[model samples]
Target: MLHGGSLPHLTPEETLAPILSALESVLGSARPVALHQPHFAGREWDYVKDCLDTGWVSSVGAYVTRLETALQDYTGVAHALAVVNGTAALHVCCLLAGVIAGDEVLLPTLTFVATANAVSYCGATPHLVDVSPVTLGVDAIRLAAYLEDIAELRGDTCYNRTTGHPLRALIVMHTFGHPAELDALAELCRRYRIVLIEDAAEALGSFYRDQHVGQWGLLSAVSFNGNKIVTTGGGGAVLTNDAALAQRARHLTTTAKQPHPWAFVHDQVAYNYRLPNLNAALGCAQLEQLPDFVSRKRALAQRYQHAFAAVAAGHIVNEPQDTRSNYWLNVLQLHPAYGHLRDALLETCQARGILVRPAWELMHRLPMYRDCPRMDMSTAEHLERHLVCLPSSVDTGSVDTGSEHA
Candidate 1:
C-alpha cells in the first residue's frame, strides 16, 4: 500500500496510482460513478403523483406550504420560504439583509459562483476573501484582521476604506456541506455591524455546535438542486428566525402582492421566484430521507478516509471540530508538495470511470469578477489546486468505520 511519506520521490503517474486504486476499492469498478447523485427512495413518487392527480402542480398549492413547514421543523428555524432555486433564495436573502445597489458584500473566493452572483443580483460588489483550510469556508480570524485594517465604521455601517462602498453583508458559505465557523463569523459581523447571510446551499443537514448552519445568519438560503442531499429537482428556501423578515421574504419572493380575492394589486417590485408545488412535493419527500442520506454519505466519507489513510500523498478533508457535515462532497486534498499532480490525478481517475473533480475556480478569477476587490487569495488558491471532490452519492458503498481500510 503506497503512503504519503513515499509520495515525494515518485513521479506524478506513480503518485496517482495509489489514489486511483483507493477510490476503486471503495467505489468498486463501477464504470461511471457520479460525483454526487440524488437518491429518491422515499415518498417522492407518491407525493408528486398526488400533485399531478389534483392538478395543483404550480406554485400556489398545499405541497409548497407543507414543504416550508417541514424545512422549518427540520432546521429549527422559525420560517422557511420556498423559492424557484438556490440562487433566487440567495438573492432574496441579500435583499432581506439590506444589500442594495453599489454596496460591497464580503464572501469567500473559494465558494460556488452562485454565492458571488447573488450579491451581484442585488447590484452589489462581491469583495472576495480567503477561506480557512479547517472549515473550507470563510477564515473568520483572517477576515477580522483584514476588516480592521481596511474597514471603518460610520455610525452602524461598515465601509471599505479604499472602495468607499458600504460593506452591507458577509456571506458565509458552508463549503461542500461542512459548516463554517459560524460563531466566530457571527461575532465578526456584530463587531463590524454587517449583516450575516449564510450561503448554506450545500449544507441542509449540516450543524455547527448542535445548531443548524442557517441559524446563525440573520437570513440564509438552502438549495434543493438535483445534485444536493435533498432534491426538489430545482428549488431552494430562505430561512430566518425573525417573523417579520420571514413575512417580508414570503412577500418579496411571491411578487409582493397584497392578499385579495380578485384584485391584481402588487405593492412593490418583487420576484416571481416561487417554487412550484410539484417541486415542493419532491422536496418534502427528499427532506424525509435527509437523515438517512446524510448518514450514508458520512459513512462513505469515512471509508474514503480509511482507504486513503496510508496514502501519504494526501488525505480526506474531514468535518471541522464540533461540526457535523453532510459530507455533500468528499474531498481529498493533495499534500502541498504534490499539488502539481492534481490535474493528472483527476484525468486518470476520470479515465478509469471514477468521477472526480477539482474545486471551483476562485471567484475573482472569473472574467466578470476580474476587477472585483479582494483580500489575499493565497489559501484559496492553494486549496483550489489540491482539492479533489470524490464520488459522494448517497447510494455509494459504505465500509465499517472500525475497519483499517476499505
Candidate 2:
C-alpha cells in the first residue's frame, strides 16, 4: 500500500478518512494554509512611512524607545531592550546570566535549535533535561529528582558530580506558548543557587498564575519573527525587572560604547545587536494589536478542540491549567495506536493544500549533541513521534483575504 505499514484492521483508505475529515474541518476549508504567518491588520503602514520619511530608520531613533517602553508597560517588567533578533537576545541573556566557558546550562531536549544554541554561544554545555507529558515542558518535580541524583551543591555553586562542570543556569522555555511550571522551578533554582532565564520567544502574551511568562525569570527573551503572534519583520527583546540587569543588557547590546555625544570612545567588547528603529516601528504597531490577536487565537484553539473531539484519531492540545497561552500554534496529538498513520496524513493534507508539521527532533538525538549529558527523554520522545502543528494562524476572515486586516 501506501509505502509505510498500514494500520492494523484498517485498509489505507479506511484509516485516512476520519483524519482527513478532521483536518479539513479544523482548517475551516481545504484552501492552502501556512502553519503560522504574520497578521498585519494594524497601523503598520503609517509607522513604516514615518520612519522612512524621517530617515530615523537605523538602530537609534524614537521608535526604538517607544517599542521598548511599550513592551515594558505590557509585560510589567521594569526594563525591556529591543534587539536585532531572538537568538541575539538569548545570547545577551546568557552573558548577563553569568554563563561562562565550560559552565553547564539546563534545557529541554524537545525544543527549537535556538534554545540550545544560545547556551553554546556562551561557551557552556547544554545539559539536556526531560519534559512533562501533560504540559510538554520542563517538569520541576522531575528535574529536582534528577538533580538530586547527579548534582552537588558546594559553596553556593551547583556542579555535576560526574563531569565536574559547574551548573550555572537553567533556561526554561515556554514550549508552544504554554507557560512552564515557574513557581516550583524558581524555588528549586533558588535552592541550588542556579541563575534562571526564560526563553519566552514563542510566548508574547502567555501568562502563568496572573504573571507574565517572562517575568518569572531573572531575564527573558521574546521574539517578533514573521511567524510569531506579533511581528516586527525580524526582531526580539530582552526583559528584566532588576534595574541593574536591565542597564547591563542595554549597554551590552549597544556595542558597549561610552555615553559621549559625537565621541567614538569605547568600553568593553560587545555586540551591535540592538533592534533597528525601522523594525521597532513595525513592532510598536504590532504590539497594539497583540491583545486582539491573542483573543482570536484562543477562539481558534477552541474550534480545533471541538472539531477534534468528534474524531477518534485526533486530540487537540489546550492551554495548561492556571495559565493562558497565546495559542501561537495549535498542536494535534494523535492517538498512540495511530502513530504510524501521521506521515500519510501529513502528505495527504499537503496534497490537498493544508500544512501540517511535526515536532523538532530531540536535541540529544542530534549528531552535535549526541555526547552531551542528559536524562531519559521518554515523554519528549513520544511527543516527537505523534505531535503535529496544525494551521493555527490568527483568523484573517478567510484564506482568500490576505492577513493584512487590522
Candidate 3:
C-alpha cells in the first residue's frame, strides 16, 4: 500500500474502471492492505497444541492469568479483566460505571458503531458528538460545552437539545491507534460528575503526553481482535485502578454465578462473555511480541511517509504530532478540492491489488443510529467524504509492498 497522501495521477472514473475490470480479471489480486493482522511465529501453534494436550482449552487455565498479567504490565492498570471481545469489555465497563437504563453516554460520531452499540446494550442512550479535525477523538471543548448546556437547562425534566438523554458518562475513543486529548476530557468528566471510559481498542501501545492511553479513564477497554496490532483471534480486556471495579468485572465476565458448580445460582442475568483458555493462549504469546510489533509498525509508517514524499507531491499523509499513535491504520484525507477523487482512489488501489477503504459512514447516519441525536456533525461529514485507510498489516514488511499485496 502507498503512503497516506501519495496516489498515481488518474481521474475518478479512470481509477474506478480499472478496479471494476480487475474484479473480474484479476481474481487473486483483491487482497486488502489491512490496518493490522495477527502476528505469530509458530509460537501460537505451540500454545494451541499445549492447550489441546492439557485438556484445559476452555475458560480456566494459566494462560488466561498470564494474558491479564501481561496486559496489566503493558497498560499500567492496577488490574485487568479478560472478556470475550472488545464489545463485551465495553458492556462490562458500562455496568461497572453505574450506567443504568435511561442514562446518557456521550460519544463521538466518528468512532466504530460498536462504541455506541455497547452503551445501547446497557439500555443507556448515546449522545453523539462531533470529533476534532486534529485528534479525531471527541473534542474536549465541545464535550464540556454539551455538559454546560445540560446543567444550565437543569433538572431531570430537561433534555439536551443535542440528545434527549441525561448525559452521565463520556466514552472517548483513541481512534485508529491515535491517542485522544484524554487529559482534558478526563478533567471535564470529573467536573461534570460524568464517568469517563476509554475505548483504547485500537491503541494498545499508544501514549498521550508520555502516559499510556488506557490508564487515563476510570475504566478502559482494549481489543485483541484478528485485526488489532496484537490478536487473540477474538478477545478483549477491561482496565481499572479500582479493586472493586476490577473484581466486579471479573465476576460478571465469568457469568456472574455464585461459586458452586453444581448449584448454578445466578444473582443477575449475566452474559457468557468469558475469554476461553485457548484464546488466552494466543493472547499470551501475542503479548510477548507487542513491543516488537509496535516498533516495526512505526518503522513501516515512517517508510510510507518518506516514500510517499518521493512518489508524488501532495499525496502523502501523516498523523498529527501531538499524540503518539500505534500507527494502527495510516490515514490520508483527500483535499476537499479533490473530494470527488476519494471514490476513485479506493477503486484504483483495489485494481492495483491493494485494498483501501473510505472512512466509515457516520454512525448517526447508519440505519440503527439514524434516530439518535447528534450535534453539529459537520466534522464527521467532512471526514467521511475525504478520508481513506490504506493497508497496514504488521506482518507485511514496509518496503515489501509486493509481498503485502500477494
Give Cα distance to truth, residue 335, candidate 1, Å.
0.9
Order of models, best lDDT first: 1, 2, 3
1 versus 3: better TM-score goes to: 1
Q: 1-406 in candidate 2: lDDT tens per residue?
A: 2223344577767877877787677676647778887877789999999999999999899999999999988888889999999999999999999999999999999899898999999999999999987778898888999999989999999999989999999999898899999999999999999999999999999999988888888999999998899899999999999899999999999999999989987799999999999999999999999888899889888878777776666588778899998888899887777788878888887888787788898999998888899998888989888898888788722554447632
Question: How do the predictions measure up, each by TM-score?
Answer: 0.96, 0.95, 0.88
Per-residue lDDT of candidate 1, residues 104-218 (tens digit): 9999999889999999999999999999989999998899899989999999999999999999999999999999999999999999999999999999999999998899999
Tens digit of lDDT per residue, candidate 3, span 1-406? 3334446677666544533443323223435544445657537878988999999999889899989999989878899888889999998888888888988788899988889999999998887899988888888887777667654334423345554556777899988888888889989876666789999999998988777888878899999898888888899999999999998888888778888959988888788888999999989888888888888778767765654443221233455566778888877665555678777677776666666788888888988888776678888788888787766777554433422123
TM-score of 1: 0.96
Candidate 2 minimal-lDDT segment of 10 residues: 1-10
Worst 10 residues of 1 by lDDT: 397-406
Candidates' C-alpha lDDT? 0.91, 0.88, 0.77
Which 10 successive residues of model 3 have the least lDDT summed? 19-28
Please rank every candidate by TM-score, starting with the best: 1, 2, 3
- Count: clashes, candidate 1: 4
